[model samples]
Target chain A: MNIPPAYVLTLSGILFALGVIGVLIRRNAIVIFMSIELMLNSANLALIAFARTFAPAQEALRGHVFVFFVIAVAASEVAVGLALIVAIFRSKESIDVDEVSSLRG
Target chain B: MDWQDFLSVLPFIIVAGWATILLLVDLWIPANRKGITAGLAVLGLIAAIAAVISRFGIEREAFDGMIIVDGFSSFLQLLFLGVGLIAIAQAYDYLRRRDIERGEYYILLLYSLSGMLLMASAGDLIVVFLAVELLSIPLYVLAAFAIPQADSEESALKYFLLGAFASGFLVYGIALVYGSTGTTALSGMVAAIASAETTPVLLFIGSGMILVGLGFKVAAVPFHMWTPDVYQGAPTSVTSFMSVGAKAGGFAALLRIFISALPGAAVMWMPLTMWIAALTMAWGNIAAISQTNIKRMLAYSSIAHAGYIFMALPAAATPEVAPEAVRAALFYLVTYAITNLGAWGVVLAMEKAEGSGLTIEDYSGLGKKRPALALAMALFMLSLTGVPPTVGFMGKFYLFRAVIDANLIWLALVGVVTSLISAYYYLRVIVVMYMRDGEPEVRSEALLNSTIILTAFGTFFFGILPGLLIKMINQVGLLDLLR
Candidate 1:
C-alpha cells in the first residue's frame, strides 16, 4: 500500500485531458485515434496501479491480465480503423476530418 | 471444457466460420455470380437461426463467464440473424442494381452479424467491448460500400469517428468500474452494487459515463444528432441494416449492461433515461412530420422508437417489476424489428432504378398503382402508430403496463401521449398513399417485389397472431439469466 495513489490518478487525469484536446483540435482521424488509445492506456494504468496498491497479492495479476486484453482489443481496433481511414481516403482523396461533411444538412 | 459450452456458442461459431468460407470462396468464385454469395449468406443466417432454436432455453455460461448463451442472448441472436437474412436478401438486388455487386458486401455483413451475436451474448465487460467493435468495424465498411458516392464515404467516416469516441468512453467506464468493484463479471458487479458495503463514488461515475456512451449508440434524443445524417447518407440497404439490426444489437448490449450491472443504482440514472425517452419520442415524431425525405423521416421515426424502448429500461431497474419489464422489453424489441424492417423494405422497393426515391412526395399515389405495396406500408405504419390488433399495440401495452406497475404512471402517461402524437405522422404516410393523386410507376423488379411482399406478409401475420410470437419470446427465460 505504499504506492502513490495521487500520481496514478494524476496520470489518468492528464491522459484524459490530452484525449479530449486531441479529439477537439486534431483534424487527422489517425491522431484522433491515437488520442483515444492514450485515454484507454491511462485507464489501464490506473486500474493496474490500484490493484497493486490495494488488492491481495494473489489477485494483483488479474488487473494486468485485463490490461493485456484491453491492449489486444485496442490493436484490433487500430487495424480496422486505419483500414477504414485508408478506404475513405482512397474514395474521397483526403483525410481531413473537417472536410468530410457530406452528411451535413 | 464442456461440450455444452461449445454448443452454446455454436451459432456464433457457425457465422464466423461462414464468413471465413465466404472470404475464401470470394477468392475463387467469379465476380459475376454474386447471387451465389447472397444465397450463401442467407443459408448461413438460416443455419444460425436453427442453431439458436435448437439450443434455446439452455442457460449456460461459456469461455469462463465471458459469454452467456442463455435465453435472453438466444432471443436477441435470433432477431439479429433474422435481420441479417432479410438485409442480405434485399442487398442481393440492391447492390447489383447500383453496380456495386462485389462479393465482399455479403461477407462483410455476415462478419458484422457475427459481431452482433457476440455482443448479444457477452457476459463480461471485456467481452462486451470486443463484441461491440466486432459489430461496428464491418458496418463502417458497409456504410461506405458505395465507393463512388461522396455521401456514402462521409457517412462511413462520421459513423466511425463518433463510434470510436463512444467506444473510448465505454472502455474508460469499464476500467473505472473494474477498478472500483475488483471484478468485470456483470453478475459480480450487480452483487457488489446491491450490497450495503460503502460503494466507491468512482463506480457511479463510471456507470454514468457508460450510460452516456451506450445512449449514444441507441440514439436517444440528446445523443441522436448523428443518426439522421448517417442514415440519409448511407446506401438504402445499409441504412436498413443499421436501422434494424445494429439498433437491436445496441439495445441488447445496453439492457444487459444496465439492467444486470447497475440495477441497484436505478434512482441515480432512471430519471435521466426517462427524460431521454420522453424527449426522443417527441422530437422524433414531431420532426418526422416535417420531413419530406422518406429516409430522413424513417430516421426520425426510428429515433422515436428507440425512445419507446428506453421506457422499459427504467422499469426493468425496479426489483419488484424487473422480470415482467424485461419480457415486455424483449417483446417490444421483436415487434419493433419486424415492423421497422417491413417499413424500410417498402421504401427500398420504391427507390427508382437510378435515383433514390426518398422524398415523401415520391410516395404519392402509390396506393392506386401498387396497392399491395401501399397496403403493406400502411400495415407497418399502423403498427408503428401503436394501433390495436397489431404487435406494436401489444408491445406498447405490455411496456406501459410494466411502467405503471413500477408506480411510474407519469412516465407511462407520457409514453401514451407520445404514441398518440406519433399516430399523426405514422398515419400521414398512409394518407399520402391513398389521398394524393399522381401516376404511380410500378417497378416489377424481382428483388424489390420479393422483399417487400415477404415483409408485408410478416407484418400482418405477426400483427394478428402476436400471441404466437410472444409465446416464442416468453419461452426464452431472460429472468433466470438476469438473476
Candidate 2:
C-alpha cells in the first residue's frame, strides 16, 4: 500500500506523451523509431515496479518474463526496421517519413 | 509440463522450426531455386495443420497457465495455418513472376504465422504482448519486401514506425492494468478486478490504451490512416495475407484480452468500442465509394469490415448476450477471411508481373475476357457486400441477431444501413467486371491453381451451408469460455 504507484504511473504517462509527440513531430523515421523504444522501456519500468509492489514473488516473475519477451521482440523489430530503412534509402535517398508519401492519393 | 500441452502448441513449434531451417537452407540453395523454399514452408504449414487436427478436442494448458489449448484457440490456429498455406502458395507465382523471389520472405511469413498461433493461445497479458510482437515484426519486413520499389520500402518504414508506437500504447496499458490489479495473467486480472476493494481508475486507463493499440492493428477507423497506404504500398500477396490473416489474429487477441480479462469493467470499455465501430463503418464505407485504386478500395472496405466485427464486442460484454455475441464474432471472422482472401486472389491474378493493374479501370471488361476469374470475383464481391445466399449475409445475420438480442437495436440498425451503403462499393467492382468493356489479359498460368479455385468454390458453398460452419464454430465452446 505504501508503494509509489503515482510516481510510476506518472513516469509511464511522460514516456507515452513523448512517444506521441515524437510520432507527430518527427519527420525522420529512425528518430520516431527510437521514441517508440523509449515509450516501451518506460512501460516496462512501470510494470516491473507494480509487480514488485503488489504481486507475490512467484506471480511477479511474470512481469520480468514479459520484459524479456518485449526485449526479444524489440530486437526483432529493429532488425526488420533497419533493413526497411536501408531499402528506403536505396530508393528515395532519404529517411524522412514526410517525403515517403509517394503512395498517397 | 505434460507432453499433451506441448502437443497443443506443436503447430507453432513446427512453423518456428521450419523458419530457422529455411534460413540455414537459404545459404546453401541457389537464389533461383528459392521457390523450393516456399514449397518447404507450405509443407511445414500443412504438417502443422495436420498435427493440430490430430490432437483436436484435447484441451490442455502449457507453461503454467501461460498458454491455453482449447476449442477457440485451436480453431483460430487452424485458420492462421490455412491463411499461411494459401499465402505462401500465392506468393510462389507472385514473387517469381516479379523476379523478386527470396527464401527470406517465406521464412519471415512462417515466423509470423507461428507468432499468430501463439497469440491465439496466449493466456496471459505478458504472453499476449509477446505473441503480438512476434506476429507484427515479420509483417513489418514483409510490407517492404520489394526493396526495389520505393513505395514498398516507404510503406514498410511507415508501418514499422506506427506499429512500434501502437505497441508502446499496448505495453503502457498493460503496465497500468498490472499496477491496478496486481496480476498479468488475464484470468488473474479478472479475479483481481472482481475482488478489488475499490474501482481501479488505472485499470480503465490501461484498458482504453490497450483498445487503441489493438484498434490500430485491426484498422478500425480513426486509427486506420495506416491501412490504405500500407496495403497499397506492400506487395499484393503480403497485403492479401495481412488484410485477412493479421486482422483475424488481431481480433482474436483483442477478444481474448478484453472479453475475458476486463469483463468486470465492461461499462468502461463497451461505449468507447461502440463509437469506434460506428465511426469505422461510416468512414470506411464512405471513403471506399470514392476510391479508384483496387488496393485502396479493399483497404477501406477492410476498415468497414473491422467495424462490423467491432459491433460484436459491445454485445459480447453484455452478460446476457456475451456467448452468442462471441460466437457471431468468431463466425463473422471466418466468413470475412474467406471473402477477403478471395477478393485479394482476384487482385493478385490480375496484377501484371511488375505489379501493375490495380486500378478499378484495369478491371474493366474483365468479365468478357476471363470468365472464370470474373465469376469468382463476382461471388467474392457479393459475399463482401453481405448479399443473400453468401457467407457474408449469414455472418451479418448472426452478428446482427446477437446485437438485437442484446437490445442494441439502434446499433444493429446502424450496422444494417451501413451494410447497405457498403454494398454499393462492393458491387461496383462487379459492375466494372461485368458491365464495362476492355481487352483484359490474364498473365500467369499458375492463376489456374486448383487450390485457389477450390477456395473460391468453398466460399460460395459455405454460404449455402452456413449452418455446418456455424455448428462447427459453436462446437468450439466459446460460450463456456465466455461464462
Candidate 3:
C-alpha cells in the first residue's frame, strides 16, 4: 500500500504553521530554538514529500539529500545559538526574551 | 569540476582557502600579539581583489552550474572586497581602543566575506542557502565578540534566534519552489517558468516566503524589529561592518533571484514590492527622527535606504529597464557603502570607552573641537539625505530614473517624498554637530581617519564626476544582460 504524497505535504504544512505560531508566542529563548527546529523539520518533510512526487524515481533522492543538509545546518545553528544564549545568560542571568530588552528604545 | 570552474571561482577559492588556513595559523599566534592576523587578512583581501579583477570579462557557468562569473558578480565582488578591507581597518582601531583585539575577529570577517562573495555568484538556491548561513554564523559570533558586555551577548542571542528562524523560512521556500519547478537551480527555474504560460500558485507562494527571509536580512520594515536592538547592542565595529556587508549580500541574492530568475512573474512580485518599499521608507524615516542613540538612528536610516534600493526592483521587471535597474543598484550599493562606512568611521572616531559617548549628543560641539571630522560626518549626512554634490544624490537620481522608465513614477514620487522626510533627521545630525555647543572631540586613529577621508572624498568626487562611474557601470553591461 502506497501513501499519497499530499498527506505528507499537508502534515508538513500543518507542522510548519504550528512552528511559526510557537515562535511568535514563546517567551523563553530555548523554546524559540525548539520552535525554529520544528519549522526546519517541517521543511524537511515537505522536501521529502515533493521529492517523491517528482516524476523520475532518482529525483526523489534529492529531497532526502536536502534533508541531510538541513539537519546538519540546524545542528550547527543550535550549537552556536546555545553558546550565545549561555553568554547572555552569564551576563544577564536570564534566558527570557523579555529580559533581553536592554537594547530597545 | 573543471579548470573553467576553478578560474571562475578563483577569488572565492582564494578568500576561503586563505581564511581557513589563517584560522588554523591563528591558534599558534600569541593571544596578546594578535594584530598580525589583521595584516594577514588584509593581504588575503588584496589577493582576492586581484583574482576578481583577473576573472573579469570571462563570464561562464562553473561548479556544476552552482556558480557563475559575469559582469554582475564581478561588480559586486569588488564592492564586497572593498567593504571587507575597510571593516578590517575599522575593527583594528576599535578593538585596540577597547583592548579586545584578537586574531579570531579578522578570521571571522574573512569567512563572512567569502560567504558574501559566494552569494554574489551563487546560481543555485542550495548555494544561496549555504552562503547565507556561512555569512550569518560568523556575524552572530562577531556581534557577541565582546563577551564581557551583557548587551553584546544579548544582541548575539537575538540575532541568532531571528537569523535561524529566517533561515528556516528560506529553506522552506526553496523546497516549495523546487517542488513546483522541479529544480533548485535558478536558470532551470527560469526556463521552467518561461515554458509554463501561467505561474503555478506554489511558485508565487514560495517566492513570497523567500522574500520574507531576504527582507529580514536587509532589515526591511515589518521584518526589521531585530535591527535597532542588534545594531545598538552589538559592538560598533561589527554593527558597521554588517550594515554594509549583510545588506549588500541580501541585495545581491535578491537581484539575481528576482531580476534574473523570475522576471516572468513581474505582475506577482512587483506590486508586493511596491507596498513593502513604500512602507519601509515611511517607517524607517519616521522612526529615525525620534531615536536618541546614533546607531539605532543609522539602523533606521539604513532601512530607509533598503526601501530605496527596493524601489528599483519593479523597474527591473522589464527587459528594456533591467540593465538600467541593475546599474542603479550597483551604483547605489557602491555609493551607499562608501557613505555609510564613512559615517560609521566618524562614529568610531567619536567612540570613547565602552558604553558611553555613543548618543547623538556626543556629536555636540564637534565642529569646534574637530572641524575636519565634523566636516566629514556632515558630508556623509548630506549624501545620505540625497543632497547634491554627493554620490548619494547621484545614486538616487539613477534609481528614480530607472523607476520612471518602468512606469513606476508613483514609487519614484514616494522615494522623493520620503527622502524629503529623511532629510530632516539627516540634517539634524549636522545641526547637532556644528550648532550645538559642547566639547566633543574626535579620537584620531590614523587608519580609521584615512578610511573616513577616503570615503568622504569619494562621496564628493563621485557626485561631481559621476560620468566615470556610469561609464564603468555601462562597461560592466549591468543593464545589457537581462534580455
Candidate 4:
C-alpha cells in the first residue's frame, strides 16, 4: 500500500504550521530550537514525498540530493544554535527566550 | 567538476579555502600578534578580489549549472570582498581595544564572505539554500563572539533561532517549487514552468514563502523585528559588515531567483513586492525617528534602504524595464554599501570600551571635538538621506527614475516621501553633533580611521562623478538576467 503524495504534503504543511506556532508561543530556547528542527524535518518529508512523485529518475534524484544538503545544513545549524543557547544560558543563567530582550527599542 | 568549473568559482574557493587554512594558521599565532591574522585575512580578500576581477565579462555556468559566472556575480563579489576588507579594518583596532581580538573573528568573517560570494553566483535553488546557511552560521558565532557578555550572547541566540527559522521556510519553499516545477536548477525552472503541466498554486505559494525567507534576511518591514535588537547588541564591527554584506547577499538571491528563475510568475509576485517595498520604506523610516541608540537608528535606516533596493524587483518584472531596474538596484547597492560602511565606521570610532558613547546624545560636541569625524558622519547622514552631492542621492535618483519608467510612480512617490521622513532623524545626528555640547571621546586607530576616510572619499567621489561607476554597472548589469 502506497501513501499518497498529497497526504504526505498535507502532513508536512501541518507540521510546518505547528512548528511556526511553537516558535511563536514557546518561551524556552531549546524547545523553540526543537520546533525549528521540526519545521526543517517537515520540509524534508515533503521533499521526499515530492521526489517519489516526480516522473523522470534524474529529476527525482535532484530532490534527494537537496534533502542531503538540507539535512547537513540543519545539523550545522543545530550545532551553532545549541552553542549559542548554551552561551546565552551561561551569561544570563537562564535560557528563556523572553529574558533575552535587553536590546529592545 | 572540471577545472573551468573550479575557475568559475575561483573567488569563492580562495576565500573559503583561505579561511579554512587560516583557522589552523591562527592556532600557532600568539594572542598578542593576532594582527598578523587580520593582515593575512586582508591578503586573502585582496586575492579573492583579484580573482573576481579576473572573471569580469566572462559568463559561464559551472558545476552542472549549480553556479554561474556573470557580470552580476562579479560585481557583488567585489563588493563583498571590499566589505570584508573594511570589516577587518573596523574590527582590528576595535577588537583589540575591547580585548576580544581573536583570530577566529577574521576567519569567520572570511567564511561568511565566501557564503555571500556563492550566493551572488548561485544558479540553483539548492545552492541558494546552501549559500544562505553557509553565510549565516558563521554570523551566528560572530554575533556571540563576546560570549561572556549577556547582550552579545542574547544577540547570537536571537539571530540564530530566527535565521534557522527563516531557512526552514526557505527549504520548504524550495521543496514546493521543486514539486511544482520538477526542477531546482533556476535556469531549468523557467522551462519547466512554461510547460503547461506544472501547478501554478504550488509555485505561487512556494515563491511567496521564498520571499518571506529572504525578506527576513534583508530586514524588509513586517519581517524586520530582529534588525534593531540584533544590530544593537552585536559588536559594532560585525553589525557594520552585516548591515552592508548580508542585505546585499539577500538582494542578490532575490533578484536572481525572482527575475531569472520565476519570471513566468511575475504577475503573482510583482504587486506583492511593490506593496512590501512601500511598507518597508514607510515603517523603517518612521520607526527610525524614535530610536535613541545610534546603532538601532542605523538598523532602521538599513531596513529602509532594503525597501528602496527592493523597489527594483517589481520594476524589473516589467520586461521593458527589467534591465534598467536591475541596473538601478545594483547601483543603489553599491552606494548603500559605501555610505553605510562609512557611517558604521564612524560609529565604531565613537564606541567606547564598555559600549558607552553609543547613544545619539554622545555625538554632541563631536563637531567641536573632532570636526573631521563629525563632518564624515554628517556626509554619511546626508548620503543616507539622499541629499545632493552624495552617492546616495545618485543612487536614489537612478532608482526613482527606473521606478517611474516602470510606471511605478506611486511606489516611487512612497520612496520619496519615506526618504523625506528619514531625513528628520538622519539630520538629527548632524544637529546634535554640531549644535549640542559634550566632549565625545573617540578612538583614532589607524586602520579604523583609514576605513572611514576611504569610504568617505568613495561616497563623495562617486556622488559627484558617478558616471564611471554607472558605465561600469551598465556593462555588468545582469547581462545574463534572462539567460
Candidate 5:
C-alpha cells in the first residue's frame, strides 16, 4: 500500500511536536538531550518520506543519502553532548537542569 | 572539482588545511610555548586573507555547486578571519591568567573560522547544515574549555542542547523545502521557485522553520533565552569570538539564502522578518538597561544589534533595495565587530582571575588605575552608543537609509528609538569609568592593550572615512543580487 506523502509528513510533524514538548517538559539534562535526538530523528523521517515521493528516482535517491548524513551528525552531537553531561555532573554533583542555575541573573 | 572551481575556494581550502596541519603540529610543541600555536594560526589567517584578495572578482562553484566562490563570501571571509585574529590576541593573556592556555584553543578557533567561511559560501542546503554544525561544535567545546569551572560547563551544556534542537528545525526545513521544490541546492531551488506559480504551503512552512533555526543562532528575542546565560557563563574570550564569529555565520547564511534563493517568496517571509526585527530590537534594548553584569548587558546589546541588522533582511524583499540593504548589513556587522571586541578587550584586561571584576561596578576608578584602558573603554562605549565621529554612526546611517528606502519607516524609527534607549546603558559604562572613584584591580596584558587601541582607532577611522569601505562594499556585493 502506497502511503500518501502528506500522511507521512503529518506523522513526522506530530513526532516533531512531541519532541519539542519533551524538551520543554523534561527537567533532566539527559532526557532533554534524548528529546533533541528525537527531534532530529523526526526530521530524518521527514527527509526520507519526502525523498520517497520525489520525482526522478535519482533525486529521491539523494534524500536517502541525506538521512545517512543526518544520522552521522546526530551521533557526533550525542557523543559530545554526553561527555558534556558527564563533565557537568562531576562539577555540580547533579545532572538536574534545575540545579545548573549558577549562570542566571 | 575542476581546477578553476578549486581556485575560487582557494582561501577556504588554505584555512581548512592550516587548521588540520596545526592539529598535528600542536602535539610536537612543548606545552609551555602554546603561544607558538597562536602565532601559526595568525600567520595562516593572514595568508588566507591575502588569498581572498588575490581571487577578487573571480566567481565560480565547486563540488557541483555545494559551495560557490563569490564577492559576498569573500567580504565575510575577510571579516571572520580578522575577527578570529583579534580574538586570539585578546585571549592570549586571559587564557594564561586563568591557567587554560592549551594549544588546542587556537586550533579550535581556526577550525571554527574555517566553518564560518564555508557558511558564507555554501550554495546548497546540505552545505549550510554541514557548515553550521562545523562552525557550532568547536564553539561548544571552546565555551567549556575551562572545564573545571562549573559555569563554563553549564554554558556548554545549555548551548549544546538548544543548538541541537535548532539544528533539527533547520534540517526539517531543508527537507520540506526539498519536498516542495524537488531540489536541495539553493540555485536549483531558485530555478524551481521561478518555474512554480505561487508559493507552496510546504515551502512557506519550511522557510519559517529555517528562520527559527537561524534566529536561535543569531539570538533574536524569543530564541535569545540561551544568549545571556551562555554569554555570562562562558569564558569571556570564548564569548567574544562566539558573539561576533558565530553571529556573522548565521547572518551570512540568512542574507545569502533569502536574498539569493528565496527573494521570490518575499511575500511569505518578509512580514515575519519584519516582526522578528521589531520585537528583537525592542526586547533586546529594553532588557539591556537593567543588567548589572557587563557580559549580560553586552549580550542584550548584541541581540539589539541583531535586530538592527535584521532590519536589512525585510528590506531585502525588494530587488531594487536588496543590494543596498545587504551592503548596509555587511557594513554594520564590521563596525559592530570592532566596537564590541574593543569593549570586550577592556573587560578582559580588567577581569581578575576566575571571572572577578566583571560587574559594571568594577569599572569604578578604572580611569585612575589604567587611564589608557579606561580611555579605550570610553571610546568603545561611545561607538556602541552610535555617537558621531565613530563607525557605529555611519553603520546606522546606512542601515536606516536602506530601511527607509524600502518604506520600512516604522522599523527604521524603532531602530532610532532603540539607539536612543541604548545610549543610556552604553553611556553608563563611561559614566562609571570616569565619574566614579574606587580602586579597580586590572590585569596588565600587552597584546590585549594593543587590540583595545587598534579597535578604538579602527572605529574612528571607519567612522569619519567610510569611503574606503563603501567602495569595497560596492565591489564585494552579491554578483547576481539584481538578477
Candidate 6:
C-alpha cells in the first residue's frame, strides 16, 4: 500500500500551520522554540515527500540534500536559540516573551 | 570543485578561513588588549576586498552552478567588506568604553560577513538558504554580545525567534517550489517553468513564502514589528552593522532569485511587491515621526528605505527597464549604507557609557559642544532626507527615474510623499543638533572620527559627482545570461 504525495504534503502543511499558530499564541520561550522546531520538521517532511515524488528526475536528489541542510540549520538554530533564552532568563528570572519587553515605541 | 571554483569564491574563503584561524589565535591574546583581534579582523577584510577586486569584470558559475561570480556579487562583496571594516572601527572604542570589548566580537562579525558574501553570489536556492542561515546565526549571537544586560539579551531572543521562524517559512517555501519545479538551482527552475504545461500554483505560493521570510530580514512593513525593538535594545555597533549588512543581504537574494529565476511569474508577483513597497514606505516614514529614541527613529527610517529599494523589483518587471532598475537599486543601497553608517557613527560618539545619551533631546546643543561632529550628523540627516548635494538625493533620483520609466507613477508618487514625510523627522534631528542649546558629551576617538569623516565625505562627494558611481554601476550586467 502506497500513500499519496498529496496526503504527505497535506499533513506537512497542517503541521506547519500548527507550528505557526503555536508560535503566535505561546508566551513561554521554550514552548515557542519547540513550535519553531515543529515548523522545521514539517518542512523536512515535505522535502522528503517531494524528493520521493520526483525520484525519476536527476534534480530530485537535490531535495534530499536540501533536507539535510535544513536539519543542520535547525540544529544550529537550537543551540543559538537556547543560549539566548538562557541569557534572557537569567536577567529577567522569567521566560515569558511578553515580560521581556524593555523596548517599545 | 576545481581550482577555478575555489578562485571564484576566494573572497569568501579568505574571510571565513582567516576568521576561523583568528578564533584560535585570539586565545593567546590578553583580554584588555583585544585591539589586536580588531586589527587582525581589519586586515582580513582588506585581503577579502582585494580578492573581490581581482574577480571584478569576470563572471562565471562555480560549484556546479551553486554560486555565480558576477559583477553583482563582486560589487556587494566589496560593500560587505567595507561594512565589516567600519563596523570593527566603530566597535573598538565603543566596546572599550562599555566594557564589552572582546576578541569574539570581531570573529563573529567576520563569520557573519562571509555569509553575506556567499549570499551575494548564491545561484541556487539551497545555497541561498544556507547563506541566509550562515549570515544570521552570528548576528543572533552578536545581538546579545553585551551579555548579562537585560536589553541586549532580550533583543537577541526576539531576533533569534523571529529569524528562525522566518527561515522555517523560507525553507518550506523552497521545498514547495522544488516539489513543483523539480529543481532547486535557480537557472534550472527557470527552464522548468518555461517548459511546464501550466505555471504551478505551488511555485507562486512558495515564492510568496520566500518573500515573507526575506521581508522580515529587510524589515518591510508587515514584517517590521521587530526592527525598532531589536535596534533599540542591541548594542549600537551591532545595530548599525545589522541595519546595513542584513538588509543588503536580503535584497541580494531577493533580486537574484525573483529577477533571475521567477520572472515567468512576474505578472502575479509584481503588483504584490509594489503594494508591499508602498505600504512599507508609508508606514515606516509616518511612524518615524513620533519616536523619542534616535535608534528607533532610524529603525523606522531604515524600513522606509527598504521600501524604496523594493520599488526596483516591481519596476524590473518591465523587460526594458530591468537592468536600469537593478542599477538604480544597487546605487541606492550604496548610498543608504554610507549615510546610515555615518549617522550611526555620530550616534555612537554621542552615546554615554550606560546608554543614557540616546534620546533625541540628548542631541541638543551638539552644535555648541562639538561643531564638527554635529556637522557630520547634520550632513547624514540631509542625505537621508534625500536633500540635494548628498548621495541620498542622487540615489532617490535614479530610483524614482527607474520607477517612472517602468510606468509606476503612483508608486513613485508614494515614494516621493513618504520621503517628504520622512524629512520631517530626519530634519528634526538636525534641528535639535544645531538650534537648541545644551552641553552634549561625546567621546573623541581617532578611529570613530575618521569613519564619520570618511562616510560623511562619501555622502556629500558622491551626491555632487554621481556620474562616477553611475558609470561603474552601469557596467554591471544583472541579466546578461538571460539576454
Tens-digit lDDT string for candidate 4 (A12-96): 9999999999999999999999999999999999999999998467899999999999899988888888877877776688998
State which candidate, 1 or 3, has the greater DockQ: 3
A14-61: candidate 5 lDDT, tens digit per residue: 999999999999999999989888889999999988888875666786
The local distance difference test score of each candidate is 0.82, 0.85, 0.88, 0.93, 0.89, 0.92
Candidate 4, B1-483: lDDT as tens digits = 888999999999999999999999999999999999999999999999999888789999999999989999998889899999999999999998888999999999999999999999999999999999989999999999887887788788888889888998899999999999989999889898777567999999999999999999999978899989899889999999999999999999999999888988899899889999999999999999999999999999999999999999999999888888989999999999999999999999999999888999999999999999999999999999999999999999999999999999999999999999999999999999999999899889989999999999999999999999999987876668776
Looking at model 3 chain B, report the run of 10 residues with the lowest lDDT sum.
B474-483
Q: Write the per-residue lDDT of candidate 2 for residues B1-483, one digit (tens) a residue.
A: 777677767888999998999899888879889878888888899899998888778776687778888888888998899888888877888888877788899999998899899998898888888888888988998987888787788778878888888898898888788777777887787788789732478888889989988898899988999999999999998999999888998898888988888889898999998899889989999899999999999999999999999998888878888888888998899888888887888888888877779898898999989888889889888888898788889999999999999888988988989889988888888899989998776764574354458667878888899988888888864654564
Per-prediction DockQ scores? 0.55, 0.77, 0.72, 0.87, 0.74, 0.88
Q: Model 1: runs farther than 4 Å from truth?
A: A1-3, A25-28, A54-62, A90-93
Q: List model 3 lDDT by residue over B1-483, tens digit each.
A: 878788888888899999999999999999877878999999999999999988777778897778977888888899999999999999897898887788999999998999999999998888888889889999999998988687887788889989988998999988888888777878877888889833388888888889898999999987899999898888899999999999999999899889888887777788887888889988999999999889999999999999999887878887788888989988999989999999999888888876578889989999888989989999999999999999999999999999999988788999999999999999989999989999875688889989999999999999999999889878763632363
What interface RMSD do all candidates show, one decimal each? 2.0, 1.2, 1.1, 0.8, 1.0, 0.8
Q: Write model 5 residue lDDT over B1-483, tens digit each, in one string.
A: 568777777777888899999999999999899999999999999999999889878777788888887888888999999999999999998999999999999988988898899998899888898889989988999999999788898899889989998998898888888888887888888888899932399899999999999999999978999999999999999999999999999999999888888987889999999999999999999999999999999999999999999999999898788889999999999998999999888889878886889999999998888888888888888888788889999999999999999998999999999999999999999899889999999887889988988998999899999989999888885654445
Q: List the residue pairs that clash in candidate 5.
A: none
> How accurate locally is residue B53 in candidate 5, as Cα lDDT from 0 to 100?
87
Superposed model 2: Cα runs more than 4 Å off: A1-5, B197-199
* Sort by lDDT, top down from the best: 4, 6, 5, 3, 2, 1
Query: In model 4, how large is the Cα lDDT of residue B243?
Result: 95
- Cα displacement (angstroms), candidate 3, residue B288, comes to 0.2
**What's the CA RMSD for each of the models?**
2.1, 1.7, 1.4, 0.9, 1.4, 1.0
Q: Cα miss at B21, model 1 (Å)? A: 1.8
Model 6 docking category: high
Across residues B268-297, which tens digit of lDDT does each residue of candidate 1 receive? Answer: 778877888888888888888777788888
Residue B314, candidate 4: how far off, in angstroms?
0.9
Native RMSD of candidate 6 (Å): 1.0
